[model samples]
Target chain A: MKTILIVIFFLYSQVQSVEPDEILADQELENVARIIGKELRCLVCQNEDIENSNADIARDLRILVRNMLSEGKTKDEIISYIHSRYGDFVLFNPPVRFDTSLLWVLPVIFLMLLCYTFFRKKH
Target chain B: MKYFFLLIIMSSFGFMFYKGLKIDPSIVPSNLIDEETPNFQLKKVENYPLFDSKDLLKKEIKIVNFFATWCGPCKIEHPQLMELSSSFRIYGIAKKDNPQNITKWLKSYGNPFDKIGLDNDGISSIEWGVYGLPETFLINKDNKILYKHIGPIMKNDLEKINAFLK
Candidate 1:
């Protein structure tokens, strides 16, 4: 019984908010939509990716992604299309620009400081 | 020298944290500001004048308001829209709302829209990058989006809107 419950719980974790009608008929295209959906942040929910979010805006975005995919829009094209409309905020992975460079740079600097303090001679 | 370097890093992190605290994370700055309004054709709402991207090019500053009859904040901002309509052309996009309901709501609130468009499926709202109801965008004479207000426009917001108009 415990093993069955664990299997059920594992299956539940795999469930997503993509409705039946929203899924593309083409298997390859549906995979692309799923991948893109995971990368795009739901603007309304803020933290959750559109693939998992149940927000109204997330549903709209999910349909939009499928529509764009069915229309033969490439993955990059679809992502950029939404990005151009909603800006960097919609992207889960922020582009490294001058404004956001600190996010990438600060971590490396902190790591270097830790290594130096830990490995350096104490004399 | 080690102590000085550590202090510098700590102070920099402290300053960054202080700046981050002052920012309201909910307000996502619009990427469309200064960009030309996106192309869209909204169906006419009831008997109101039709609105489209071409209407945005006219030689006058205009306001594009994304609202819904179901949204409570839209009703709250209705009075401000009425006041603003006296000075600027206000275009309304009723997102995913029934035309009859919109007509009744307008009658009750007193219509402030110079032209009202029906965004029946909400595609137009997506084109405008609207994630929430009662979003307002101020467009300049050249059709560039000048400013965007996310929520209901309250009494105090009038000054900011007026300043943007100038």
Candidate 2:
């Protein structure tokens, strides 16, 4: 039991301490967690961010964020934590790369098509 | 003209989405719907016997509220709860709080609960699936939880609850 405790404690410390190499990983991931947390609305809370909410579930998620930070997890993994639980509604800034590509490009596409159509008519 | 049509559709979509956000997302369908009332006992502050959910069984609807003295939204939702007292049986679960503070808090505002139970440890709250303060549970005649509202009840919610009562 003592050996088990020592091993667990060792892992816990290893997980918590950011090595020099892990520093780059930590800062990058921590920044992402903070930004995503700002955007994702707390599901049970009325008008509160996941970071600011005092709800127990929010606290759990906050702990998850910090633990992931210590373990050297990335931005995508952090967003995925909230995404799996609460859905996209939690995200303040929706990811616009692929699934939401249309949302990002439709305006530019429409403008370009309009300009093209106008030029064609003149021709 | 085409851009104008696009603009109109997009704006309406945005408006509708924002309105939907305003609609309380707490009532989103959960599997826990229609579950049995979680076991809890609280010392009724009116100096009565210890009130438990099992004791409240009757052929009428009941409301269970979880509030704390420190919760600001609880204060805001107090009046709406008071209004519901006439229509249905409402019990208060003071989560992780002091009985004296709760009694004093209610006195300043006014007690809406028929039996306010002191949930001092909040262990009972976990069984009830309480995630935060100002939450409410609507139970049917059979003591089955029909709906759970996560935040403070507002005037519009009271109207909706009234409709359900009817």
Candidate 3:
């Protein structure tokens, strides 16, 4: 019973929103689509990735990603295409531009300060 | 001096969080503003003539709205849209909606669109980077998208829309 429950939990957690019709026949291409989908933010949901979102836009994006992959577009090219259309908000990991540099640096700065404050007190 | 630096850093972070709290994260800014409108030629929902993006460039300014029959907010926005129609060249794109339903809905709600495009596949909405229904885009004669308003347009938004149209 415990083993069965664990299996059920695993399957439930792994469930994705990719509909059967959207799946590509080529396994390699499908893998690429999955990777791309995981990276693209669902514009409607804002917090969820397109791969697991049930929003209509997310479904459109998943289909678009699969189509692009089948058309022989590279992963970076696909990402750039989406980024160009949707802007920085569509990216789960925002690019380090001048404005975004502070976002990337501040966490490190905070960590360094915490370490310095702790070590200096001990010494 | 070190304590003062820590205080400044903590205060700045606090200030940033306070400002961030005021912003609604769901309202992502459109990248298409000031850029050329995405070219599309969709069949009219009922009228024989198709809606070509080229036609939008002929006017001084135009409004293109993405709506669906099933959307509740779109129904709410219809009357205000009708009020704006007399002054603006407002075009509609019925996203993934049946023509029959749209025709029926228009008849019941009152038709505000100068031209209604049928976006059955929703490809046009994707090209426009439309994530939500009842989104409106204002474009100039140059085909540049001047503004994009997501969700339902309210009374306050009319002032802004008028400013752009003017």
Q: Give the deviation of candidate 1 from the true structure as CA RMSD.
A: 2.0
Q: What's model 1's TM-score?
A: 0.95
Per-residue alpha-carbon lDDT of model 2 for B2-115, expressed as tens digits? 668658767866886798788866643333467777666666665634568665577778888889998999998999988998777788888767777877887888877777
Clashing pairs in 1: none
- Model 2 misplacement above 4 A: A1-123, B1-30, B43-49
Among these predictions, the greatest TM-score belongs to 1
Give the top-scoring candidate (DockQ): 3
Q: Per-residue alpha-carbon lDDT of model 1 for A1-123, expressed as tens digits?
A: 999999989988765999998888899999999999999998988789999999888889889999988888999999998898889999999999999999999999999998888877563
Summarize candidate 2's per-residue lDDT along A3-108 as a digit string, tens digits.
Answer: 9999888877622222233233457666666665676666677568876676665555555566667787776776775564345556666677788786677678
Q: Model 3: which residue pairs collide? A: none
Lowest summed lDDT over 10 consecutive residues: which window, candidate 1 chain A? Answer: A114-123
Residue A47, candidate 1: alpha-carbon lDDT: 89
- DockQ for every model comes to 0.69, 0.12, 0.73
TM-score of each: 0.95, 0.52, 0.94
For model 1, state the Cα shift of residue A77 in Å.
Answer: 0.5
Candidate 1 lDDT: 0.91
